[model samples]
Target: MDTPFEIFLSAPPGLEPLLLQEVTEAGFAAPEVAQGGVTIQGDWPDIWRANLTLRGASRVLVRFAQFRAFHLAQLDKRATKLDWGAVLPAGAECRVDVTCRNSKIYHDRAARARVAGAIESFGGKVSPEGSLRIMVRIEDDLVTFSMDTSGELLHRRGYKEATGKAPLRETLAALFLRQAGYAGDVPVVDPMCGSGTFVIEAARWAAGMAPGAERSFGFEALPSFDADAFAAMKAEAATRRDTDLRFYGSDRDDGAIRGAEANAARGHVADLCQFTRAAVSDLPRPEGRPGLVMVNPPYGARIGNRKLLFGLYGAFGAVLQERFHGWRLGMVTSDGGLAKATGLKLSAGPPVAFGGLTVKLYQAQL
Candidate 1:
């Protein structure tokens, strides 16, 4: 086993570069990006820093060990042979979430049962709240075990009490903002800002606040988790301030505005942002400044009325063309046909995947 160990930080698809940049900036050397994650070598502080500072990552995982097993009995024997106490403390809440891609152990229940039984033998009970979420991949006859250091997904910033029909993940919202090259000086306006994730994330970034400052991570529950060290890290982080940050957002639904307001208040960014009820067509652009107009509109999933949303997009596009000049646009859409309804010219090209969902993050020059 490596001393400081190598950990993989999972990210939304096509966002490996974003996460890679975060790792590099956090003092990790030359992070290698993969399809859904980036691997870096580090000790406990690196893991803590990644949890606290990485704005684009979804979960931090430690690749503990790997073993070969041909059958279910061999799997159980191999699992019990490895050391689990190193990651999880005695009688800690532990659970295994396995994903078998192109593997012979295709049965999920049996896998879960085997892992659960093995873990239980060591007096650790399975719970919904598992600090250690072990992901096992059994391909051909090879098996790999990885432990999740990030307990709750980082997107659950502990602020969003009320969510919209199609809520955007907070990590994703921040990544999209960074991808747009936002430096917190330019105004960020989300017209269809359901639940205010984009605005709140922007406010946090602008304020120089730690993304996981107010929240807790699964690693906190580990035996290696040091409260004073984490607290000192947080206190050190709270010293920086971005007083000039300008963040703003709006939504047509009255309930969504209320929810956004409530959520932003909890995140301590309510005062930093402006929220109100206004249809995307009537969204007023700020005067005399080049800002970002990013939108995560309804994608016709549930309560997805495409015909009605088309007009909404047209109005938004018209506003972009007529009133908003020099404003950069970042629109997230799952449907290519629906994105065309807006009719914004593609200045920055190509759409990317987010949350295993292939959504195009397009930019338009207006």
Candidate 2:
């Protein structure tokens, strides 16, 4: 348990560099960018901290062991040699997921069965309904064993039960906030806010609250889990501090506004957030120093008509240009022409996959 292992921070595709920057700033050691995520060497406690604090990671996985196998017989022999008892708690129930590529053992189900049998040999239970997950990847004849440290998706955040149609994910909102150069120093506003995702994320980040503070992790069921130590870590996290700064959100839909308000209350940031019903044409500039105005409006693909969306984007752009002086704008949409309709001198980031549609973040100074 004292020996360091590989920790993988799964990030949304096309946002790996931003997540890498975040991990580096978080003071994790020797974080290297990978194809789908970032990899770092750490012990068990580092796993806990990564899941608890990282706002951009979609999930956390720990790679405990790896080896080469030519066939199912060889894979079973190598897997049985692993000290499963050292990692999984006695009689632990877990589900195994396997992916095979460029390997002699191309049957993923067979590999999963072999590994599951090996785990059960150590008095552990393999069940599809298990709370814990064992991840197996066999690529190029090399097999790797990993465990999902995060049971539910990290974006769940345990507080946002009320969400709007095609709502922006909290993890995506945090990464976009970072991309917009928002460091929690000033006000944040989302005029077309849905469920207050951006505003609540900004408020929590500004207040120094942990992203996973209100949630439980799958690692708690592992043999390495130290409940007392995890409690101490949570206790030592930065507490909420009173600040004059506020995060504001408004939407044309009254029901959306109500849901946003409820989300803020559940997230314990109602005092720092204000949600009201308003239209894009009537969006108000909050009274404070110029900050970030981040919004995820209807993409036309999900919530609105594509032909009618141009006028909507044009109105939003006009409002920002007229009222939001010195503020930065981050707008997300799937159509490039709609972004151009804003008539602002905006630049776009790389394409991001969201809800089966390709979206990009358009930014500019207002």
Candidate 3:
């Protein structure tokens, strides 16, 4: 058996535990949660599966090599000695990003230059805008090298070309769903759905669809990538299970509803998700046992005036309380006062940094 490589699964700072749970449930062995991410050991096929299947990870990185370098000369010498061909093909375009802290090689630009020069000497073209990234971190006199196996952020999903103002990311939506105790067996409804991220993600998860099934990964360009093995893995992951439950999303904006429908179609979950245009005042519970009513409503940080949003949230809460009995609510908002204005008995989770603002998930059992 080949030796397992160190894989780091990056998530938003506050979402590490959720991501760790996802990694562990996805069958990655003994994942350890670290600051801002989760660490696991896996072979190259596991790397492909991690990118293909894990929904909460922002990116996946492979810690390919590490060494101690006392100076720039030592760094250059040690970098060149590594087998570049094992990961990067000769003449492949790559980018070197370096960060230095508490180390003799303190100049970030200089460190990047040395690593770039070493890669160039090994017949790799250094391009700052390249998709393939080699990240170098110098901490406490030790230099560590990691390759960004996920080229684009995993949330892109190669779908959702159209979105409403301040749409939620798929990764964050997945984490919030998990935090709210959604396990794909029950139906989900997003009342203030912007572009159907929550509904579509729930549908996909319920159907056992791989989040990256329609996307390409950065590791495909690496020299060590196996096309046949990856294809088999992807084929196996693409086998979807039947879902009796339907996911629902509603928005007042017709454009947003149209975009959500298109996005759901693109994500191959349109059959399982229903997107409609309806205001909070007119939102109705779908026909089923109520599961989770998750919504990322407009807040002062991204959309409408904070003062005006209070009425919107209050109306939302009123509608849910009046109609949807025996349901759970998970709402994302940056303002505690606004969440309280809903008049629901909601418990706020830890604040999560999102889109340059601190937000929390306000959950309640209705």
Please provide, for model 1 over 37-147, each residue's C-alpha lDDT reduced to its tens digit, 9 standing for 90 to 100: 799888877888888878888998877778877668888987887777776788977767866656778886788788788788877888767656777777776787887
Question: Lowest-lDDT window of 10 residues in candidate 2?
Answer: 235-244
Q: Which prediction has more favorable TM-score, 2 or 3?
A: 3
How well is each residue in 55-169 modelled by candidate 2, as lDDT tens digits? 9999999999999999999999999989998889998999999999999999999999999989988899999998989999999999999999999989988889889999889
Error of 1 at 34 (Å): 1.5
Ranking by TM-score: 3, 2, 1
What lDDT score is found at residue 136 in candidate 3?
95
**Estimated TM-score for each candidate:** 0.88, 0.97, 0.98
- Candidate 2 residue pairs that clash: none
Residue lDDT tens for model 3, 1-366: 134888999988888999999998889976999999999999888899999999899999999889999999999999999889888977889989999999988999999999999999989999988779999999998999999999999999988888889878898889999999998889999998888999999999999999999989999998888999999999888778998999999999999999999999998889999888888999888887879999999888768999898899899999999988999999999999999999999999888998888999999999
Error of 2 at 332 (Å): 1.0
Query: Model 1 Cα displacement at 245 (Å)?
Result: 2.5
lDDT of each: 0.79, 0.91, 0.91
